[model samples]
Target: MAEKRTGARKSSSDGDDGASSRKAPSKKAPSRKTPAKRAAPKAEAPRRATATQVAARAAQQLLELTGKEAEGVTGLGRADDGWTVEVEVVEVRRIPNTTDVLALYEVTTDDHGDLMGYRRLRRYTRGTPGGE
Candidate 1:
């Protein structure tokens, strides 16, 4: 009887084994790109002060300058560069509340509510007409 092959053998026509005839798909990494730059935002300007803010600042500054307590805001007016505020303060104490002496101060401040200057306009008793 003739001898038979026991295991797999290469094909003479393709020079490879039967299992190596089919190949696996190839694998590759994806490409990358650099990021773009962005521009910075602009800054905002300072805002103007309101009538109430200006009045409060004027009263506070007057108290600091004269060492007196502010009683109330009597007047407020807008200027070209800032504001003019009139503040009332007690200058002297008396037995009767109505007889107490008070003073009106004209306070000037910049648009940002910074004290520019201040001066006492007039002095009168609490019961005086129009607080004059």
Candidate 2:
């Protein structure tokens, strides 16, 4: 038999007033975020050019000589003169990868031919722009 607490009947045999004495829990709203407590932002890095930029410059020079596009260039360094850019070039007629490409030079002078660091980059079609 169910136990009766004063007037109400309960499942427990002890006549304790559990349902009458306890109150229901209330729901709370989320707290607002403060600007002072926010996380710090990250900084960005500077960009750099790839090795391909050098080869393109060399190929562009070769095209001016042959009247057609050159495919690639190789030797890049300082010589007896100013900034020396020796480029190997193949006209568009022969095999694209032919070893017969003429090595045309694209040299920049410092008023007196001297050494500036240069890169003999990848094989490219001629008319490549002056790189950054």
Top candidate when judged by TM-score against the true structure = 1
The whole-model C-alpha lDDT of candidate 2 against the native structure comes to 0.44
> What CA RMSD would you report for each candidate?
10.2, 12.0
Taken over the whole model, the C-alpha lDDT of each candidate is 0.82, 0.44
Model 2: CA > 4 A from native: 1-55, 95-132
Q: Write the per-residue lDDT of candidate 2 for residues 2-115, one digit (tens) a residue.
A: 334533543442335564566648577676665664644445443322234444554554455445555344455443443455655443444544333333445442223322
Model 2 vs. true fold: TM: 0.29
Candidate 1 residues 34-103, lDDT tens each?
3443244445567888888889988988888899889999999998889999999999888888899999
TM-scores of all models? Answer: 0.65, 0.29
Indicate which candidate wins on lDDT: 1
